[model samples]
Target: MSTIDHPNTEATSAEARVTSDPVLVSDVVRSDRLLLADNTVKNHVIAATGVSLVPVPLLDLAAIMGIQVDLMHELCKLYDVPFKEKLVRSLLTSLAGAAGTVVAMATLTSLAKTVPMLGSVAGAAGLSATAAAVTYATGRVFIQHFEGGGSLSDFDPVQFKELFKAKIKEGAQVVKSFKPKSTTNTDQTAQTV
Candidate 1:
């Protein structure tokens, strides 16, 4: 058998490798959507980690929540699901409530910032990780739901409880892999987007 050198190279892509086969085309499109969704999740998770550094008790968590909501809204757009802010918020609360310990840890981490001097440091340390994990898991579960033809209107947080917990563990590793982006670049990217 003969093999091409550097088979791992991007010389062959999902679309390029396949003919006009409907099944293969659908697979390529699905694969592309997944990559896009993953990118969107990573960007928002990084932003949430930054927001966790806001240094104010509860305020940081509040900011992180807003970021999570925005992440969900973007995912909704990507999946062509109805984007209802109020419904999303309710769904988020349900998710967080199901996250129980993760949510509690995040709250405790945020509250730790109330200390006179060391509070900021402690909160920043804990909240950043917690926020990244929670945000990432949220994005991931949403992506899975959308991929399975589920919409936000029928999303059940209870059904995803175990998966959400597992994803939080996965998310911690993902967050550590992300390097912080510079403010100038972030600002420019935001403006362009």
Candidate 2:
């Protein structure tokens, strides 16, 4: 039997070492984007009503999820992992539970809208808060998974459910901490006037 020449073990080991390291991206930028998306969803959830409200959170969530997927794609490229569009789409679709949460929020908001005063009093605040929490959880999940060298194939939503629930509580705190820009602007205007 003819023997084939093997490549240098040292070269293979060096390549493995280089590839194993985590890719460095700007966490600040990522966090800012995630926050912006969460705020946008919150705003939309607050402003929308009736049938219009049903889709707003879902749409915003989809947009934010898209951005997160793009961020993941960049990380995958840097980490020398495969990043296929199909895989990204599959991962996004697998987040149906989050979408279902948004839908539930929308349904509640719609029912609340049927009542005259309850729409503004209960639905807006409650649904918007839920929207913020859900958005935050989604962003956090993607960040944690991608940062931990997880790929689309490696993702398991069932395994992440507990972490996502914990993150929702943290997200509520973050949302509570956000001071609306309109309030800040009004304060500045009052000072100037």
Candidate 3:
């Protein structure tokens, strides 16, 4: 048997071999839109002050949080970072306070729906705002970490908590300033018939 020698195949580590892919701003924007839409719908329902509908939006908020976590993973993949599925658990543990608040709000919303007079209250708006803030904070943290040459395995949730909170406050302002899309007047359009 003739043996041919391969040069330095074992020298390169997997981490060193992985190269960054192009992560576009547009992709992030699209993901943000998804998060926003989820928040908006829940907010709108809550704002309607309908009792039976409260639970529906609260349930949706939980689902959206899951989606947000998935989005972080997706963003990590786009930035060529090693996707660590376990990181999600670590993130939740580190941000337990924030995550717990969201859960509490969801629980409250659910309870409000079952109560007689409480269903008509306008507390859902607060929950909606929280949803938006958390989504924004989560995305910002992941993006900053990925951009700083950190991968999922290197992510330290405790170290990033303060930064995440700052981002959450900023994101809350953004959510406050958010304006819905305006409708265009179609009557002025030229007809091709």
Relative to the unseen true structure, what is the C-alpha lDDT of residue 4 in candidate 1, on a scale of 0 to 100? 66
Clashes per model (N, Cα, C within 3 A): 0, 0, 0
Candidate 1 pairs with clashing backbones: none
Model 1 lDDT tens row, 1-193: 2236657555556556774455767788889889989999999988988987787788998898899999988999889999999999998889988979998999998898888678888888889999999999999999999999999889999999999989999999888877565578788899999
Error of 2 at 32 (Å): 12
The sequence of per-residue lDDT tens digits that candidate 3 reaches over residues 100-186 is: 665576456555544455563434555566666666677777777766668777778778878877877886777767757565566
> Model 3, residue 91: what's the lDDT?
70
TM values, all candidates: 0.80, 0.48, 0.56
List clashing residue pairs in candidate 3: none
- What are the runs in model 3 whose C-alpha is more than 4 Å off? 1-58, 98-110, 116-123, 180-193
Please name the candidate that would achieve the greatest TM-score relative to the true structure.
1
Q: Give candidate 1 misplaced runs (Cα > 4 Å).
A: 1-23, 179-193
What is the Cα-based lDDT of residue 75 in candidate 1?
93
Q: After best superposition, candidate 1 residue 6: deviation in angstroms?
A: 35
Residue 172 alpha-carbon offset, candidate 1, angstroms: 1.0
Give the range where candidate 2 is weakest over 10 consecutive residues by summed lDDT.
44-53
True-structure Cα RMSD, model 1: 11.2
Across residues 82-182, which tens digit of lDDT does each residue of candidate 2 receive?
88877776665566464566546645754564566656456556655665565566666766776676766888977887788777778678777774555
